[model samples]
Target chain A: MSQDTLFDKVWDLHKVSSLPGGSDQIFIGLHLIHEVTSPQAFGALKDKNLKVKFPERTVATVDHIVPTDNQSRPFKDNLAEQMIETLEKNCLEHKIRFFNIGSGNQGIVHVVAPELGLTQPGMSIACGDSHTSTHGAFGSIAFGIGTSQVRDVLATQTIAMNKLKVRQIWCDNKLSNGVYAKDLVLHIISKLGVKAGVGFAYEFSGPAIDELSMEERMTICNMSIEGGARCGYINPDEKTFSYIKNKLCAPKNEHWDKALTWWKSLKSNENSIYDDVIKLDASKVEPTVTWGITPGQSISINQQIPLLDDLAPNDKLVAKEAYEYMSFKPGQLIKDTPIDVCFIGSCTNGRISDLRVAAKVLKDKKVSKNVKAFVVPGSEKVATEAKQEGIDQIFKDSGFQWREPGCSMCLAMNSDKLIGNQVSASSSNRNFKGRQGSPSGRTLLMSPAMVAAAAINGKVSDVREFIN
Target chain B: MRSKFTPPIGKISNINGQCISLIGNDIDTDRIIPARFLKCVNFDSLGEYVFEDDRKTLKGKHPFDLEENKNSSILVVNSNFGCGSSREHAPQALIRWGIKAILGESFADIFYSNCIAIGIPCFTLPKNSIEEIQKYCHNQFLFLEIDLKKSLAKSKYLNFNLEIKESSRKMFLSGEWDATATLLANTSLVEKKFKELPYIQFCNDN
Candidate 1:
């Protein structure tokens, strides 16, 4: 047990009761719902004839099914239209606040919650979306749940959860200029393997992590689910407190100082015990990219795809499957593989900073004629900010479509999708087969700048070369 | 909107059914109920589309589509079963498709928990025992008797103890599988705890 880790402290604080079977009745402070996963949960509520126990604790947003290209009412996809409409009706009926399509606060649930300052330190947050861990950057214990769990949260404001073992993932040294948080997470996943964190909650700490911006820390926590951790979080600091202060849903007036004090104390103690601890040198990590279907199958831009003989016996099966599915040469340079589409958005890399970095790379540089590139802001607020900074124009000038915010092409629930065997360089999380639309489509996951680098060169190229 | 009917939550300590073995490692939730099927109007009728893509692509050769495997209630899987995306529909689809229980070498954390909440138990047997069970499934009409209370599974060719966690097994036995009721049972305590938080209390004051 990692005594006094941020995760442990948060988990202990939120624990309402211990059930007879080694599970805690954990109270959820914030419940985020999206159109894709919430309709069923709402339906479940109707079926069982139950009302939302703590409606105020829940927030609704439409992302996974909303169209990024069109903002017209009555969406083109009948299913998408029905789903959003259902969400609207559910929110209205339940009196839960919803950030709809045109709402300035509207965006991906993960992005919306934090930007609104609803995601705070020491809160136990649950969402029907896997990337819910994105909230963990503020020192919250956040994890993704299923619709049934969503239903559980809706009806009770709490979920019965088994306490998780804690693993302290220490990131040493500051990352070099060109490398981003997305690359750092990918590098961590590649070393840990996807299933390594199955029964544990990862507490990411140490000097390098402490140096990251809130959004950068968010990028790292966002993909903690990829490594199979139930949840992941970084302890709150001055940076965390400052990022959370004075926002729409954040504490105001007299409560501000009191809230700040509580958040400050939420950090782990000096000598905390951990079930396990893993260390990574951030300085050594490069702008990394996934070479296969799984997030764990990745290599640095300067490295080559691993040969079959180089893999462990158990790993060879998936590696062989990856080599076949990706159609890349076993020992080919990871930088040489060409890409057809370049998408730089999703909960993982859809924030303003991610857009700024990608825009910086795309500035004055045209996207390759062979590549289809686009930038989708994580939220409407991020989109507004990017437009203010003129980042969208830079993307447009570079031949990339500057689109509205929604989880576009991330899971491909909307019109944006890969056609046939078109491969993509995406800044979104998850490179699972058919993850970006077409059943045969392949996705290479990397940071926004790396995706921009690939878009300009029409191949998997090193972002370091593109950066000043 | 079509008002479909869903079966009441199941409560049984033992389930005996013919097994449908999906013998693969890291068999993800996407493959179980592909992302396309997740956009349902409701979760009630998702069972028909469970493994929709697999059934469509592998058609006659797919186990779920096989005449013999139809109505099979027990599913046997290899390591890391239900690994990706925390889609409750994966378990909802499985339960709806007539799967009452799942036995495997290992199970992903989310998938395992989701299974419990929906009244489906994800039991982990030893690796070799799981292998024996998978091998046994090849036989015609290979029915398995899984006793939840005893944590044992038996068939004509194999008999082994399953490693169902004490907490999870107790959940099934004590009828505490549905967490909603248990959580609702402690409403006052939850409210008391919520008010204690300075941040939340401040928001309410506004």
Candidate 2:
């Protein structure tokens, strides 16, 4: 068991009691609900005739099923409109704070919370969505839950869970120029393998982690689920405190100082022991991309897809399936592979900083005519910030569509979907078969700058080339 | 898909059913029940669309679509089953399609908890044993009688010990896997922790 790590500290602080089943009943400091997952949970509560125990602590938002092209009232898809309506009704009945569309606070739940200063260090957060781990960037103990657990949290403000062991991923060196946090995380997942994090909560640390911006840290923690860890976090630091200082829900002047003092003390002790430790050199990480269905199947932009003979015996089955599904030959270069679509959005890479980097790459460039490229901000706030900075205009000038914010084609619950077997260079997290809509559609996961570069070239190209 | 769907209830100590083997590693939630089918207020209709895309691609050749596996109530698979997304609909869809228990080499964290939360007991076996069972199912049907107390799965031809988290096994045997009631039992402690948490005091806004 891990001791004295940040995860242990936060978990111990929130534990309510030990249940008869050997799982701890931990109070949820924050519960985030969304359109896609909460409706069913609310129905379950109604079925059980239970009321929400701590309605004030839970927050609601609409995403996953919202259309990016239109923000109007009734959605074209009746089922989506019904789902959102169900969420609206549930939130209203439960008296929870909801950031509805056009509220200026609406976006992806993960993006909206941190920007609104709702996510904080030393907190235990739970949500119905898997990317809830994204909030762990602030040093909180956050993880995703299924609908039944969602009901448990709603009814009792606590959940029965087995504590996760902590693993320290120590990155020794700073990333080189043109390499982003997305690349670093993808590299980490590829190195650790997806299932390596099953019973562990990854604590990303060392100089490379400290050097990343708040949004970059969020990007790293956002894909922790893809790496198979239900939760991943970075220790709170000056960057974290500064980022949360003046947001909508951040503490007031006197309270801010108190929060900061507590946050500073939230880090792991100098000699804190972790359940496991792995070290890597971030300076050696390149702009990486996923070539297979799972996020673990990745390589540097310039590298070729691995051959079956080179794979470990355990990995051969999935690798063969990936090869067939992706239509890629063994040893074929991932670069210069043609793409039909280019997408830049999702909780993973749909922040203002991601937009700025992509806009810089697309300043005087034009998207290839053969490709349909679009940029959906992670939230409405990100869209507003990008417009104020003229990033939207730059993308428009480059023939890329700048649209409203939501999780657009990332999971394809909305109308934005890949048609037929079209291939997409996506800034989103998952590249699972049919994850982007069409059963045969393919997704190539990359950083926003890489997606922008691919949009300009109509194929997978290294973002460093554009940077140089 | 297989009679009217009925959910599992209290004290699930024994599960005797036909085993349906799915051969793959890292079989994710998205593939189990695609994102397109999630736009609903309930999971009642999810059974018809479980593995919709994969089933469509396989053209009735999928194990779920096979005549012999139609009534299989236990799922057998390889490593890292249910690896992506925290969607409970995946397991709901499986249970609705007649899966009452699962045997795998390994399972993702959230998905395993989700299965346990919804009354599906997921057990594990060694890689070689799982592979042997999967191979055995390829030629003929394998019916397993699983005893949660002993953590054992037995068939006429073979017997092996199963592995499950002790806490999860306890939850299943005691019917505490429906965790809301168990968690609610600690209401006073929950309120005390809420009051004691430093962030709750300092962060001000709820």
| Segments of candidate 1 deviating more than 4 angstroms | B1-10, B55-59, B138-141, B204-206
- RMSD to native for every prediction? 2.2, 0.8
lDDT (Cα, tens digit) per residue for candidate 2, span A102-145: 99999999999999999999999999988999999999989999
Best TM-score among the predictions, by candidate number? 2
Quote model 1's iRMS: 1.8
Residue A249 CA displacement from its true place in model 2, Å = 0.7
DockQ of each: 0.57, 0.80
RMSD over all Cα atoms, model 2: 0.8
lDDT tens readout by residue for model 1, A299-318: 99988899998887667777
For each candidate in turn, the interface RMSD (Å) is: 1.8, 1.2
Tens-digit per-residue lDDT, B39-70, candidate 2? 88899999989999999999999998999999
Q: How well is candidate 1 docked (DockQ)?
A: 0.57
Which residue pairs overlap in candidate 2's backbone?
none
Residue B16 lDDT, candidate 1, scale 0-100: 91
Predictions in order: lDDT? 0.86, 0.93
